[model samples]
Target: MEDSEKNIELKINQISQKLKEIRLSKGYTSYETFAFENELNRVQYWRIESGKNITLKTLLKVLEIHQISLEDFFRNL
Candidate 1:
């Protein structure tokens, strides 16, 4: 793969890891539970945590559910 592609993949992995950590830290043992409670589309959320492509709108919904500000998310990242 090209350097740019590799970098993007690396970033996706990082984001996915962080997302998983946040859910676990919040006492969610299952991503499904988290998604249901947060009114998120379970499939889309799964994709996000799986390091697959997701829309910005969906990501914003996740942040809102977690009460995570964009600033805080980026800072943590």
Candidate 2:
């Protein structure tokens, strides 16, 4: 892959790991539980947390459910 593509993939992996960590730290035992509490399906939540090319709207919804602002999310990274 191109250097840029490789970098993007690295970022996605990092983000996915961080998302999982944060969710677990917040006492979410399972992805399904988190999804249900956030009003999303398990599959959809999995895709988002896995950095699977989800839409910005869905990303925003996920962050919103976690009570995290977009700015804070980026700032913390």
Candidate 3:
């Protein structure tokens, strides 16, 4: 893969990791439970947490659900 592709994959992984961290901090050990409680599609949320298909809009929605600003979300990343 190209360097750009590798970087993109790395970023996706980081985002997925961050999402998991947020969920855990929120007292959710299961992604399915988190998705169900948040009214999100479980399968879609799984794919997102797996870093398979994450869009900016979806990310924004998740961040909004957690009441986190884009700046704060990416700050540690």
Model 3 whole-model lDDT (C-alpha atoms): 0.94
**Residues 1-77, candidate 1, lDDT per residue (tens digit)?**
99999998988888888889999999999999999998887888899999998567877778888899878887856
Q: TM-score per candidate, in order? A: 0.91, 0.86, 0.96
Candidate 1 residue-wise lDDT at 47: 96
- Candidate 2 lowest-lDDT run of ten: 13-22
Quick one: ranking by TM-score, best first?
Answer: 3, 1, 2
Report lDDT (Cα) of residue 20, candidate 2.
79
Per lDDT, the best of the predicted structures is 3
Off by over 4 Å in 2: none
- lDDT per residue as tens, model 3, 1-77: 99999999999999999999999999999999989999999999999999989989999999999999999999979
> Among all windows of ten consecutive residues in candidate 1, which has the lowest summed lDDT?
53-62
lDDT (tens digit, per residue) of candidate 2 on 1-77: 99999998888777777777778989998999999987897998898778887677887787787788888777766
Rank candidates, lDDT, best first. Answer: 3, 1, 2
List clashing residue pairs in candidate 3.
none
- Displacement of the residue 26 alpha carbon in candidate 2, Å: 1.1
Give the Cα lDDT of each candidate.
0.87, 0.82, 0.94
* Per-residue lDDT value at 31 in model 3: 94
